[model samples]
Target chain A: MLQAQYVDGRSTRVRTVSLSVSGTDLVITADDLQRAEPLAGVVFDEQLGNAPRRVRLADGAFCEVRDLDGLRALMASARLRDGWVDRAQRHLPWVLMSVVGCVALVAAGYRWGLPWGARMLAQRLPPAISAMLSRQTLKALDGGMLLPSQLDGARQASLRSQFQALRLPDGEPIRWTLLFRRSPALGANAFTLPDGTIVLLDDLVAQLDNDQQVMAVLAHELGHAQGRHGMQLLLRSSAVGAFLAFYLGDFSQLLAAAPAALAQARYSQSLEWQADEYGSAVMRANGMSPALLADALRLLSKSHHDAAGVSYLTSHPPTAERMRRLEELAQLRPVQPSH
Target chain B: MDQTTANAPQPTAAPARQPQPILFTGRGSEYFGIWIVNLLLTIVTLGIYSSWAKVRRLQYFYRHTELAGSTFDFHGRPLRMFYGRLIALGMLLIYSYSVRLHSLVTLLVLALLALVMPWLLRNSLRFRLYNTSWRGTRFHFRGTVAGAYRVFLLNGFLTMITLYIMAPFMHQRLKSYQHDNSWFGRTRCSFHAGAGRFYLVYLLVLAAIIGFFVVLSMAGVFNAFASINAAQHGGGRVDPSAIFRTMLITYGVAILFGVSIGPAFHALINNLVWNNTRIGEHRLECRMSPVKLAWITLTNLLLLVPTIGLFTPWAAVRLAKYQLESVRLLPASDLQEFVDAEPESPGAVGEEAATAFDFDISL
Candidate 1:
């Protein structure tokens, strides 16, 4: 219950509005204001309904009450009368945004997502092919068994020692046979097969600066064996490139690259660099100068200049690049003392 | 004595109204159980379980949720939600046939439908969420998934033009929309308005790192070329050794391009998305310094490399909890008048009569 307040310098108190509730609606009537003013054209609700109800005072001012108790509460609490501002509703914009957010995720999943998934699937095919090629190549080399007893004593000992150190990712130490062939058809070259077989041509071994140079270069080949670079490349290429080959109407192009890819296995520039760095690290760890490997590259480049105009190093990139990388590693102070 | 007196309750003050406890009717265990069951079922059925499970999950959330002691009921039909998937699948089938037969028009039609199907489905879901009620109190969930789609499309368009430097700002604008649009009945949601600057910082730092790599590549190429030329023709006596040195330089270039640049970019993107976000009263806020965030993301990403993909779920859960716990709501109290009716006993002051005596003035 609210106490009525007296007006300043007036004999009468301020008028009170009475509320009547029915269901959800509240009806408000000011009896004193009606008696005093007798306003025209204002329809008075004889009964209150459940809907929101509004009442106009004698002064032509208006107020709305949703229910009986609401009307009473408003009169009691409204100490300082203030106007409220209602602009455009925010609900529509919010609804719009949540939809957009979900749509973006879905779109991203579709456009960029599915293609990557397909590529991942395609990437699984080449390792099988490379492993097959490596095993087949090794089997062929192993059949050409040249024993150390057939070799000259000094060269046989060095080859035997190097062969013992060569190992594959599967923990099988490589066996090498010396092929003393001087034919132009099978020129100076070295290659490894999948089943722990390393083949060194007589001419290629004879051309190296020293036994260590041959060892450093052989270690790089062994890196290819350890990393399974040939197999990985073969698998990746077959997976991605087979589709490309079919789309281009020529599978032979990929087939031609496959043999070369396996024989030399020119790694991605990163892998090649990693192998070089790894070779240098191993050389230094084994009580040899890392620069000795770079020196070996310099010697190989000289031999290429003398014979083929461009070195084997110059086939992919110039010799200077390989030398610079090896030199950089050599310059770094070894964290562990050289053995 | 003075300190104790100051701490005492003020005399003649009206008793403070006790705040209503926020009862989390949606239990974590219940939600987790539903998720686990759905996950198991999905795995068992080879993902076919998602269709029925999604409908059930939504129904469970709708049934258990309460506002003003009224549980909200979802009136939506279960089968209708698969409309999006159906439309997408249908369009894809048509498109595949068209492509196989070399029909350009059918392909275009398929593309257009693919763009529009999600939009239509979003509106349907929004309507369902909005029309639900808790007890007698209606749940007025704001924001349509469709509207969010449009904003994303527009933001994507803007970001592409700006070379993606505008992405963080665009993301923030999207958050604002999500915040402002959400409402409980007529009460509108609001957000902390000061987080845009932080989002911008994240964007700029990410942009700078990318720009650095692009510049670095160009510099590397030039350096490689210059070294080659210098070695080839530096003196009157043309040193053949210069060519061999050039071969060695390629190895170093490969390392920088392969390892350093790729990991750095991944780190930058991860940091911006992770560190910048904090759920405010209405919207999410990004407060982290982009550089610091990038560093942390990179470190974690590097560490996670050994775990394969197993660590991803753990990271996702942590991020979700962090984001959800940061969320705060504006203290907008619901105002409703409760009037107790009097019994119809004789000579009793009827509730209506007593209420009438008390002036229920309008304001």
Candidate 2:
């Protein structure tokens, strides 16, 4: 017999009752044994720590029991077994295996799966949608960060013609337009919009020693355009951001955005290497020295340190590594002098 | 069983007058196991199992918290919570994506969220309390949506207008609204804290922060600031160490202020709220020490940072143990006189919406 307190569903009155499990039924008796209720459809609450387990009866009355072992015996004899979740919670080895599996899966997803998915998705998206997105971004940039080209109109025309004349290694004719812009904030940089518009900053062109170096920089930007790196980066970061916020309780907005930005920077580093490889290939196919790309990178890295107090090392890592690879490529394939 | 002595246990005279302190019997090791399993399962299911995980976690905490030898229980269904989370995630996706489309759309979404926030908050409180029970009697929140809007939004706007001088008063009003409208087994809970007390706490925190910064500025720390100014005005010969020193001083001051003032205010407010609260004839007594709470918090953070948050379960258990141990209840009548009362259940939608928007108002 178990000591319990029973509450009737209609009234808020607590009555002292004696309970005993008889086969499949729970026999409840009054203090004096005058009244008794044998409950058939009895439901026991899930065991939570040392809390009193509630036994809900079919007739709407309920009993609270504190005897753990007795309740467990009753539940088992009644054929009411604990669920798989309860078993999982009690078993330590399974729990440890689950923890290891979860960690491995998350790490793998972060390292490769998300970026690969983003790349595939970006490639599948239509050019028209990417162009629209680029247009909106350029309009925003023009309104704040970018200024009209400070280079002379004749120089701009000559650079545009030279950029158009360069051919890619795939033998497919390049369809791209060159634009010149002056952005003091950006200092010396060249980037491509999704619509194949390569914007060469005035500082970058002025810093280069020869026209071949400028063309090499343009070739790298074209590589980004071909790969649609911008769209892929945007999609990948958003996916990672959503995943982080879901797993970890949504922290502050700035805290959530920081990790996504860092992940994107890491992705950008890999994209930069790919573009460097493409730039080297273009330089070699056109009978120009791949060393021109390396020379431009070295000059930019130097000027980057001199002009800005901010270190570009974190955002664009592997500059030194890519320069080394470019030098190796140049040595492997000697440049053919074409006047 | 103890029922053998039930016939002789008739206490017809006077009941015990001494107040009983609440007990937290949860062990860090046991809780750590549960937490790790919950985290693993939640991740394995791609966050779909988080609702179940949350329920299990809450149940653990609730069951381990004992008052008068009977522990509390949470009766929320995991499937209901899962549906709530799905709706919340959908709304969050829409809101986050809308910001990239246009500024006007973002503004519209913000305004819409603001309008519905009070309703969500009220419902969340109701849902949370309705699912919580002690001794088979469920806790209930009777706060209305209109009342929530008045206390949360209208007074919030006034506090902003007064440049946060009215913030303490607004906080008191909200607390009063929440406490006064809550019930346990047909007995209402009441709050009797004054805005003046809250104001004093806030003012002291503000003064301490200001005084720390003032003292730092008066010290030679401002010499770094002067050097940075000189560097800016002079040629590009900026001494990096001077800038670094300034940043170091700023960060140190900020951390010191947070460590000292944040815990002090938290302790004071918690003490005030719990001490002034009454459930029917029973009154709560809080004995939380600000210095002790601060020490525990700082040490927990210290341990947590070194472990990369692996000690979170232990830290949480420690904090809960301290808080629950400090609280006691003075019963004015026989504890057994209180009967079980169940209220209408509030569904999970409101709680999920509040969570989705991250509208976690610490009380």
TM-score of each: 0.32, 0.81
The docking category that best describes candidate 1 is: incorrect
The top-ranked prediction according to DockQ is 2
DockQ of each model against the real complex? 0.01, 0.30
**Residue-level lDDT tens digits of model 1 in A202-318:** 545666778777777666656545555445444444434433232122212433454335434343454467567666655655555567767777766667655643234643445
**Candidate 1: chain B TM-score against the reference chain B:** 0.46
lDDT of 2 at A81: 73
TM-score of chain A of 2: 0.80
Please list, in the order the candidates appear, how each scores on TM-score for chain B only. Answer: 0.46, 0.80
RMSD of each: 24.3, 6.8
By summed lDDT, which 10 consecutive residues of candidate 2 chain A come out lowest? A246-255
Task: Estimate the lDDT of model 1.
Answer: 0.44
Q: Per-residue lDDT of A236-325 in model 2, one digit per residue for the tens?
A: 887898776654342124345777878887788888888777877777777778788889888878887678733223356567887898
Q: Worst ten-residue run, lDDT, model 1 chain B?
A: B354-363
Question: In model 1, how large is the Cα lDDT of residue B209?
Answer: 57
Chain A: TM-score in each model: 0.48, 0.80
